[model samples]
Target chain A: MSWLLALPFFIPITTALIAFLARGRKHLCSVISITGCFAALCVSIAIVTLVVSGGPQAAQMGDWQAPYGITLIADRLSAVMLLISAIVGLCVALFAISDINENRVKLGFHCFFQLLLAGVSGSFVTGDLFNLYVWFEVMLIASFALLVLGGEKIQLDGGIKYVALNLVSTLLMLTSIGLLYGLTGTLNMAQLHISLAEVDNPVAISTLAVIFICAFGIKAAIFPLFFWLPASYHVPPVAVTAVFAGLLTKVGVYALIRTFTLIFPNDLGFTQNILLGAALLTMLTGVLGAAAQYEFRKILSFHIISQIGFLILGLALNSPLALAGTVFYMIHNIVAKTNLFLISGTAQRLAGSYELNEIGGLYKASPLLSTFFFIAAFSLAGFPPLSGFWAKLLLVKASLDQTAYFVTAVALITGALTLFSMSKIWAEAFWKPHPQGHCKSLYSLSVAERLQRLLPVSLLASITLILGFMPEPFIEYALGTAGELLHPDDYLEAVLTGSSH
Target chain B: MNSIILQTATRVLVALILVFSVYMLLRGHNYPGGGFIAGLIAASAFALFAMAWGMEAAQSALRIPPGNLAVSGVALAGLSGLMAIFYGDGPFSGQWLTLIGAKEEDGIVISNVLFFDIGVYLTVLGAVLTLIFALEEAS
Candidate 1:
């Protein structure tokens, strides 16, 4: 159980080394990578079990204690996050197995993908803030490689913007870490909590808070800082874009929630309201951006920015209910976003073009693919009886509890716009008639057509449906996780106390 | 660019760069000679080395992957903080034992906090190196 958290860290890296050495052995490499993913899943499950059964676990690396040696602690929230990352990772691994091979059997793709997984899984589980920064760099570097895996013209353009923006964010984050250490004389997350709990310099504290927010905001694709996301994410392959859209931005949001609730609690007055306004604007603008897009993946990319706003809104509300909502919303978004992007890939694969103007009436051509796409679309739009609806409900309820009528109204309106954008994809691709002149341009599929495409799509779509129908486990975990995050004394104690480690 | 002139010039430049980086690093304890400066200075040494030699040659001299350097640096820095556990000084506790130097916070505060600076230096060097290498390789 103690070693479970380390599994996610070690497996991807080892597989990456193996894949790197095996260069041309694509099949073997993919198999090994999938097994690594499986191990991560099993490890995550054990972590949850240990957290629930044993209450929580923290241990210092190399027998050194906290605020000193590095600690990898698993509290309720970390475990829950670990579990969700694993589940989503498993789906992505499956999708990538064929996706990477089919797209192009390049060494860079597999090597970078494994590295990317390692970064995400490690970020989700690590206890130290500095380690979190390093892990984020790991993820960012790998993602930079992944984004440009094809070395396409558009990808390079997008990659340039992505790298520049994120590099700046990392600089901000590092500078803030240094200043924070200079101010409070500590870097351990828990230690900082105790160290700065009553530091009286409001000006200094708020400045650091703003720095942290701007740094994370760029990553989370928040209101004014989000121009890079839709522009960049739209250019990658559906598989790449889906994973990026699903998991990457949320890492920023997760950092925000962790830092705000735990370390930067001194100046919630102005900070909370500004963040709240940003959240509302992020959602409204994102959906409107989605409304204007005619491309399949671009709209989904825009919604990713929008939905992230909903998640952050929960954190801004700062109540336990809102925290729970944030957690629930994040889980839903990851699965739903990934599934929708894969569907887009599958759609593009079958229909031959991504432009909805030319690629209409896919339903008539491939009913199974269309059905899967519809399920994912409905989830993205937060339709009733879908998991997205529940996540959205939690957010609305959380906002209402705080009596933030304006935010609630903005969320509700954005939900409608979300539905509208999704319906356009549904209408343009599934209902509208294909162009008679370009009929000959459509791609031909053989007997194994549905088998090749439907399995990946159906698996992801079913996971979304299952979560929607039976959200009890996820909700319970989210509640526990949110409670632990909002009141992180246990997390603080875990790192600072020798026995806690 | 014969092998002799290149090798001798590169070696001297590298030596000079390393000395400069160390100066920046240690001096940063009180002034600007902290981890960030140190890391950059060390990385600049390597960058100079790469410029004089080739990427492959310079990387070979590194004796380990840049990524490992980053991880180890982070670990070393973090290890310093965790040192408090053994002393019961609480997390990130500072131990202000006297050293050979005078009672200045600059030299040998005998604190775990100083230990973290070393970690930061290595991490910065390794991270920058990794990025430069990746970018060069990508291009």
Candidate 2:
């Protein structure tokens, strides 16, 4: 049974190995990777179903009891995250087959890709705080390789800044983990909860809490620390950047939500107010930054920062509805943002450049691609009857309930500005005539390439539509997950239980 | 710098270091020696070989690319964890088999833990050598 929890990451590890061994066989590697990801997706869905029906499940590594051994726990929050991650992982792996070139495949792209997925899955499922740190390092190393794999001048430039800043964040996280360990002699998150409460130093706790906020905040790309994201995200290939955009920062957000809710429950008045202020600035800066960018992917990268503000707002509000909103928003944002990146990649291929001024006639050439870009873009802008709209509605209502009118106002205005940015891209990239006077339409591509690229975008776009149309079940799930996050009793009980179940 | 005396000494030293690294790896289960230090020690021996005999000699000595070795190491490590599934235990759960059974703790015990340690040893050694070899070849 415990093996079930380990399979999500293990499948990726094995796939990476097989793919590495089948080095020159690109088709075989792609087949191995996609099948492995598909299998992991199935496992993730199974875990979610089990968690939803049977409550949280915890598996102790090597049959050792918790608080002494590594633990993998699957509660509603983790289960939902695992499911979304699997969906994104499978989609990205499929997209990479045709999108990535032969040179990259020969250079171990598929191996590192699987390793990155393994890291993401590991981070979501591990119940040990120290283990989470290890997973973060795994993700960092894999992503670093993916970023600079091509060894282009621009990639190296971007990789340097990305590595430098992320390393600083890693340093901060380690320091705080050390401090926490000193405060409580345990690293297990479930036991940390009890041990932290026993800590007599309120000041030390708050200080450590602030340090954690900064550490995770950097990772999440919140306001002041987000420059690295826009600088580097546009450097990688579209498939690589898509996964980075969708999952990497979200891991940071997940860490924030986990720590703020579980470890630093005290000093809310101080910590939360700081978070609230940061959220507003992050939202304002991200949208304004997006507005300034004329390149396609650059704009989307900035918007990621803006969207992170909304997820943080949910945490800042600290309401059940607000938390649920963040949960829903995370799923929505991951799909929408990834689809937009994939669209930008397709647009880059279609028009031969990522510059907004250079790329145009996409709508005239292929309405299907334009339609996808429109759905994903507008959905990101929180248009009604879309998934982002429901996400916005929940946060807005939550803010109003708390009588935080300023936050509500910022939320609405950010939505309007997000729409403006989306329209700017639409008008420039899609509606405008091509500067070169001619461009290949999507239909001009071979069927295989089109199928490889379009299939993932179409599938993800349909998910956004489905979530928008029938959000009842998803909302219920998010709400239930939020309840579990707020009250981690089930999580703690499962982790602290003596035997593996 | 390309002295015959240095090359001869390196050849002898490399063999000694390789043997000692394996001892360190095996002794790690119960003593201070472990996979990481053993791997580093092994890598240093190859580094010395590279310095003495030139890049081509070091490359041929390894016989496989360090990247391939690293991948195989990771595969071995992962498979070691999967061994526990046959025993209905968690991933990486240690399953011990005593060769001469009769009394508890009186025989040579073979376990998945040792396999895991060996995996880690190879992974570190391969990864470290890959980076150094690439840099050396480039230069």
Docking class of 1: incorrect
DockQ versus reference, model 1: 0.07
Error of 1 at A431 (Å): 1.3
lDDT string for model 1 (A292-408, tens) is 999988898899989989988998998888888899888788878888888887777766688888787677776767778778788878898998888888889988888888888
Return the lDDT, model 1, position B81.
54
Q: Over the true interface residues, superposed, what is the Cα RMSD of model 1?
A: 8.7
lDDT of 1 by residue, B1-139 (tens): 2376767788988888788887876777668678888889889888767767778777998888887777677667655755755665444545455575755645644655566888898889888999888887777
Model 2, span A93-124: residue lDDT tens: 88998788888888889999999999999999
Report, for every candidate in turn, its global Cα lDDT versus the true structure: 0.79, 0.92
Q: Which stretches of candidate 2 lie over 4 Å from their true place?
A: B103-105
In candidate 1, clashing pairs total 6
Off by over 4 Å in 1: A101-104, A436-452, A499-501, B2-139
Could you give the TM-score of chain B for each candidate, in order? 0.81, 0.94
